[model samples]
Target: MIDEHRQDLAAEYALDALDPESARAFEAMLANDAELKALADDLRETAAALALDAPAHLPPPELRERILSRIRAEAEAGAPAAPTATAVAPSTEAPVPSGGGRNLLPWALAAGFAITTAALWMERGSLQQDRTALLQEARELRNRDFLAKVKIATLSAQVDAYSKATAVIVWDAEKQHGVVKLNNVPPAGAGKDYQLWVIDPKYPAPVNGGLVPVNAEGIARVSFSPDQPISKADKFAISLEPAGGVPKATGPIVLLGGN
Candidate 1:
């Protein structure tokens, strides 16, 4: 048996009054459960009371005869006909009139027309809601695409920075080798030539790679390996040094890289 909560939900579904998500869930339940379908059918019969009585204005005489003939034909064929206009009785209430002194027939027709127009208006509102949801989804997709492009641009900039810095020095981690690829470094005459220092921020002191001439350009690769692993270095720098390389750097840093 369907649970009490589910039966109530089925009743609401039969009335066509459930919210969208809840309606979809109930429809799925009805599709799979025969018992739920029967319960929904019963509730539908009950709610048909809203449509029980036709309006006071009768349909034209010929239209009424044609309707009755179709009903009689269905009865003779021994097939159960779907419910027809006969299921509803005519309303006896006198029609209310508008201020223009016209017969109530015109006003009743106008009111019925207005009701149909209102139903169409409600349908249009649902269509607009669907359109709004689609627009929001499109905006989200555009934002995602823009963010992806931004990420690509940022990565490209980082790659360009790495390339520019690599042009200044050629360091090979696998061979523990360092090479000076540039010549004529700045600040040449200040009692110091460019000296490479492989420093690890995790270590106490910088390891001397070698002293390099300011104008020399033929790959001044160093023989020294870094004291700590290269991965642990928070900073790397070239310092100005005297003719012979210093055991410890006492000069100003010329270039540096770090977080």
Candidate 2:
């Protein structure tokens, strides 16, 4: 029988924050548990619909002031913090990366937050339309935060290195995932592919970043999310390589720029 602790994981699971072993355990349980599966599916659906919600509502006034006051009161009282959460019982699976896998728990939690918020406002004497307006505001806040967490870096063509080019890269350093947009690049013909490289103080050698296929319109766009973490990009460079990328840089460099 799954306990409340396990139930609480529904939100984390939906957010893909479950530990690997825990994730596997949850997945196994999910496969055999009809109710759990339904719950996960519902979360996924709600999260997907967040974008369609109405405009965001402004947060309650004085919320910040009240929070700060609490903090001050805690300091004055010299409150001792509770110990960190205890270790979870041993799990059946191995640990996995934070960003890995797709779990619907987070969406469920988001939906719950929105629904509960609306219910609260209604109980506080808000009308149906007002509650809906509140939900939209909450959606907008979540969407903004989600977007802000994603890191993006842009690079322009290095002088004397490329005829004409510009690039935009969106990367999640923690997740080691990113997409590269090499715009106005020279056409890469058959048997040739464009390779990207990462330069960071952490790695003496440049990381063998992913490759991009150039389109007829002179653009190469590719998305990558490596399992291993990549340091802050000191420099992003592009080079020509064979259909399959090489382990090291060997061909002529096409474009280069620093972060």
Candidate 3:
């Protein structure tokens, strides 16, 4: 457990408010004491997080005009007033710098202006980062929205051999990918496996869309990527081909569905 004194030192150190002598002493101790170092690190992280929580405030809209007006007033006031009607004896004391008040006021005002400008620049940079993050998020959302609007086509048995079988193709045209869901599908013949195909007008022949593997329950949901890019999926079909499948469909069409 850390003592309150140590915790206080850590907090001051984290805020960078510790005197140089004390800070050096604390750092030396921190290097030797793991527990104290951990406490200091935690304080630093908390301080950084608190900084982010600070609300952003811009300088008042009228601040610039007010400063300019003050400068003009100071300049006018610095001018020697019309000579007094009655003259006085010259002072024996050494003269003060001419327009000392006027000079100090401008320097003060310039420092203030510089601080405000720096703050404004920092705020602008933070806003730009936020805008960039929002744009990236919007782009991701659009891509997801486009992907969600997939084309769903239902595949039915093409012949009495698979009259009881049913499948559905959920195709994403944008990604050129799709998944085939089957129900009540029977096992393929010995030495033969089921294959998937995508019929696209862009291709001379049907594009192979991988193979399908049905479980013992006669149901399955398999994902496939077509061998060639498909702009439009005109039709989805399942065929019986040799085991391990073929490059191009070379077997009887068992199930078929059209756009």
Candidate 4:
């Protein structure tokens, strides 16, 4: 049996009213709980139908009169009978208007409409916020997808000494920069650092990308901008060089990629 708390969670999930963490938790539960999933699906369908399928129609003109008449009849039926004997003193109370009860209908309708309009206005603001957030999230995803598509190269170990190393160079020619990621590569020897190079066909030699440092876990990620403009990055390479880096690669190239 789904408890009241779970039912409320399901309702909020259906309405997209839950916060991110709570929504994720509820979705995790739904994956394993068939009954909860079914209940959530039903609530979603019901909520959608109420929002989209309900027709807008005003109450009939006679509806207000009927309601007022019923209220008056009930009030009169509940009142005690008037005293049989008449007293001598005249009353001090103000006279009641003859149409006093009839006047209540307009005021009642006005109050009801005011409350309904305020509620609808609040709902409209909340929906607008949700739409803005969703649009932003979509834009971020699109940017990431575009970046993924432009990845120009993936490099692997070129020498048996660095056989376990894996590297990738994600270049963005438009921005004149790229990111290099290395995994399972051994740390550089003492007083030596790993250097990166970009072989541009226009240059006589490779352009010094930068020094790379690997953590104990053999993983390194560096954002690099080459010293020279690369008309075409024909190939990328990583080599062992003295501390800092070298303008020219004197050590063996351990990792290489591209034609």
lDDT of each: 0.50, 0.61, 0.72, 0.70
Off by over 4 Å in 4: 1-149
Error of 3 at 219 (Å): 1.4
Best-matching candidate per lDDT: 3
TM-scores, one per candidate: 0.30, 0.43, 0.44, 0.47
| lDDT per residue as tens, model 1, 1-259 | 3454775576456545577899998889889987567557545543342223213333344644454455446545864455454564556987666455575578668755765565556456655776688667644653454222211000001222222222123234434544433322343465657676766665678777677664433222233355445644344566767867688888876655422
Q: Would you list the rank order by TM-score, best first?
A: 4, 3, 2, 1
User: Taking the tens digit of each residue's C-alpha lDDT, what string does model 4 give over 160-250?
Assistant: 8677665656566656777677777888989999999999989999999999899999877777889998878889999998998888889
Residue-by-residue lDDT tens digits, candidate 2, 116-183: 56545544543445568876765555445544444434454554545456555555465566667665
Query: How does model 1 fare in lDDT?
Result: 0.50
lDDT digits (tens) for residues 130-195 of candidate 3: 678866765456345633445555566787867767565666676566667777788886898889
Residue-pair clashes per candidate:
0, 8, 0, 0
For model 4, state the Cα shift of residue 158 in Å: 2.5
Candidate 1 Cα misplacement greater than 4 A, ranges: 1-167, 216-233
**Alpha-carbon lDDT of model 3:** 0.72
Candidate 4 positional error at 91, Å: 14
Deviation (Å) of 88 in candidate 3: 56
